[model samples]
Target chain A: MCTCNKKNEYIPYPAKIESVKKESFDTKTFRVRFTDKNLAESFQYKQGQFMEVSILGVGEAPISITSSPSRKGFLEFNIRATGKVTDAIHALKKGDALYLRGPYGNSFPLEELKGKNLYFIAGGIGLAPLRSLINMVMDNRDDFKHVKILYGAKTPADMCFADELEVWKKIPDTEVWLTVDKPCDAWGCSIGVVTELWKETDVHPENAVAIVCGPAIMIKFVTLALKKSGFAGKDIIMTLERYMKCGIGKCGHCNIAGKFVCTDGPVFSYEQVKAFPEKEHVI
Target chain B: MSKMIEKKKIKGLLKEAVKQWHTYVPQKHIGGDVLIAPLPEEAKELEAALDNISLADDDLVISPKDIFFPQLETMFKFKKGEIAETVESSPKLLFGIKSCDLKGILFADEFFKRDFEDAYYLSRANERLIVVIGCINPPRPGACFCTSAKTGPFAEKGFDLQLVDNGESYFVETGSEKGEEFVAKYSGFFQDESGDAEKAVNSIKAKAEKAVELKIEFQKALDLMANDDFIPEEKYKRIGERCVYCGACVYTCPTCTCFNVFDNAKGDEGTRVRIWDACIFEGYTREASGHNPRNQKWLMACRRYEHKLKYDKAKTNMSGCVGCGRCLASCPVDIGMSKFVQEITEDKKIM
Candidate 1:
């Protein structure tokens, strides 16, 4: 057994804000270049894993890595200006410095989804992590079978990565659908919740993997829709969120039942979700 | 082997130990009472408080958890606008921990160091050496159930050294390599004589066992608590009603290791502090978006019990309660684990 009481200090890698782009009205995507270019080159992360973005005085927030590992040079984080830390992060500009701790937590098992028809569903800011995986699968298009992407936002202006979604829509054998809760006159997307488009697609449940992320209510309906449409528990995967203070699992904030989202999972199979006691209406 | 030290020599031993190491012992505090304070030179004139006083009936005056995991500690400090960091570490000795409190410390060690290790907690925990003072007398009124939990009067594991008071001197049983080193350093005060020491220790053990009023089948109580058997809603409410929400029970609990991390920053320089937090607090699990998994007092009460009886047991193979009785003492409304356990075990009526 390993000896107890080992002191492992968190090494802060300096990441410079290379550039920042406003993705939505309240959200921005940052492209950071690490001080040590080798560290940036060596940094490898699976989709759904998150990093601790620290603004020295403000504190750290676990943000999902938005850019795919396949597309690299620097890392990317799509953050919504919500709380104190995120608000501080929003004030940062190019040439400012930030500290990153990890590419922590279990990520999506892309290898498990290999050669299977994939259904990707996301709502609002939830598309951040899913976008990374979608890009990776698109790069390795021949390894995966049929692909379907259904996305939703509160409004047309609330949508993130619209240009990227447009590009994915042009890919062969990939079906991309977008929806808005409320539609404007110029909006060309479907006018309804993402769940409303469930009837428009035909998916093979036995040979498909469905990945969904969104607000708790939206994810609930999406999961139910997927289940009713014949996806088994194992074929469905999700990324769960909680108020995690310590990304190392000691602070006890991210616990659902006995599982620590930081250590045990942020990514879980629907079968595991079904077994959790707090399985009611979880996003 | 245990040996006798004349009561008069207790002061001298403490003084000598202090000269060599930073020793902490119980001392008279304000309010004309005693608490676990640093043993000063002049304070040694009084009799060793470890022997004269019995465990408090209401609450332990001080929790032993502080000896290892202090309430407020700086894990590391970072300078403003600079990425430089420095961690603080210190070494000290704890002198008068009781058997039950020692067990609680052991429980904390297991909890914090297992599965996903906490570097900050572990780093601070490594700096101390534990010296356990065995309980030779019965605990005051509120202290009974520790013997039932198999973690009282005397401890078998966790402590570096176990000291049993044998009227004239302490019978020191070295439990770890650190204890052996401690004995070696103080070899002048000890003599090798095993037979008499064994007899004295046995007599003391027998007296302590007879003095204990609390008795229970701990495994059975644990099993019942974990079982899906009906737990009356009224019983839970009665316990909740008695809770003043003071949070003293959780604060004093050695095994209650829940914490909250907050950043204390001024400009670009600050430190992240992990402070002790209890599940009973209103906002313990409150989300940034104002959602809480446990919003009611009854649910909080259930969560505490489940943590002690169900969660810790399943994870660590040990009951969370070391039966330290601090909760019983510190609680303003007289609600404690002992009373709760007694109610659950004896009152078949449930309410």
Candidate 2:
């Protein structure tokens, strides 16, 4: 993990893409190996922290770390070809060189969530960042209380890490509820929006910390669902996405008033989000 | 401490200073006015030009913010998968800057140096020297309320040197140690003053204060708005409606420091650049998924006023508006700070 100044000036460590696995038609996960073995060995990132991946001639984009900190020697990022930089990133193949700048931002308060029940909600590709925390909790399964993951995608084909989700189903004291926007003959997951599946779960909200990430629309509805189910404002945490040009706070693009989402948060508590003067419900 | 310079030898003094430093002065152009282009080679042309050309207030176009916090600066460069290491900056001297404009630079300093220091700004700022030329003449039309804002025709800080034009010549006042060094280097051009320097400076201050006709009780307005109960949503909307959302006020205003960064890429080497961004833009608050927190123009307008007048005051013990009145000049619909404040204080509904 590299620490940067306010200007985000730091030494860039070279990294080579070890492999690129297509998760979906639009999304692929890149596993990268750092050039410096010691730097790679000491590398640590919490859930929700992102790295500024630069493709020399192409620009840099903030991509959330998908691989768990418990996992070693390599890092993973699930990239969707949504914009210019990501499109350039998607064009790269195995052995392509790049530069990484972060492990920037405060992460999930895992220590605070240790004894609490964990309710993980993810929509579409949002599972990438949440997977880090989920894997960590699974590694130390007995340290945490009841863990349940409710994931939803636009369709059955859009779901990411299919084989990993199947493995998660066999973990003791863990439950995985998969949902799709529409039902398909080939799909075994529940049909309808993720919020609909959230309504069916009898979550012990008083003793649980709910971690949610997804498209803004999905997160909005999921937040309302969690609130209706008795989750306190502070108990709900969500990772936000904005059009950030600089992963550092100097670029004003990612700021919501005084809070720079790039630095202050990509993850914020419901209490913090509510304090934003411009916040409005989409649904 | 302030000192006086001879009224007769102002041009000679400036010319001598130019030999050593990168000096800038207002120059007239067909388009309007621009700050000091490099001095011409013909020394007589430079000297003769100063007499006919006084400071061009209309030509005062570029904000000093660009001098320190550049619009498109390369933070670093990378090539062949390795970070390229090269840093170069030149010392600068900005002359004939109006006092209100000087205050704007001071505000930027406070913001960049607060809590988390911006080294990029500091690095650039450290390389420059500011020489403020007091606004002997008030700004045209809507540029009168800078005195009320306590940043006016004269400034106390953020200048290495201050030159007060006293008809025959200029009365120079050293503002920083850098100013003193420059003075000491050119000790031949300066002469010991006979206490008349103090009287000249006082008279200039008196003239500037008298020239300011508009006034506002900034503290009272700030107090009224600080109370959430006093400021209503409907009144805020009413005030905001008058704004054209052209972003001219933000672009011209000296203290608005919002910026956006993007990359200009070519082949394998790309430069990430930070450009000026305004809150008034529709996309400023837009999310990636097409949702915007500040979706309404009226709401954004309200935010601009509240952030400068209320929030910045609370955070830094200073109002964000330096009262340069550029907004008043630039706004197509004349709903700038002066008019906005008058409406807020006079209208019972808003008060």
User: What does chain B score (TM) in every candidate?
Assistant: 0.87, 0.87
- Maximum-DockQ candidate: 1
Clashing pairs in 2: A57-B268, B7-B168, B7-B169
What is the lDDT, from 0 to 100, of the residue B229 in candidate 2?
44
Residues A197-265, model 1: lDDT tens digits: 876667569689999888777878888898898888888999887767767777776776667788788
What lDDT does candidate 2 reach at residue B321? 85
The DockQ for candidate 2, computed on C-alphas, is 0.35
lDDT of 1 at A136: 91
Q: Residues B1-351, candidate 1: write the lDDT tens digits.
A: 444445466555666787655666755554645455555444544345434433232234667677666676555556855654444444567776778888887788887777667665666566677787777665444455678888877888888887777765677787889888877877777766556778778898778766777665666668877764345667877777667677888887878877775678886677766688887777876766576656667766656776787667877889998877777767787777777776777875422
lDDT of 2 by residue, B128-231 (tens): 67878877667544455778888867887778888887775667888899989877877877766666778878898889777777777666777776664465
Name the runs in model 1 displaced over 4 angstroms. Answer: A1-11, A278-283, B32-59, B138-140, B191-195, B225-244, B343-351
lDDT, candidate 1, residue A241? 76
TM-score of 1: 0.90
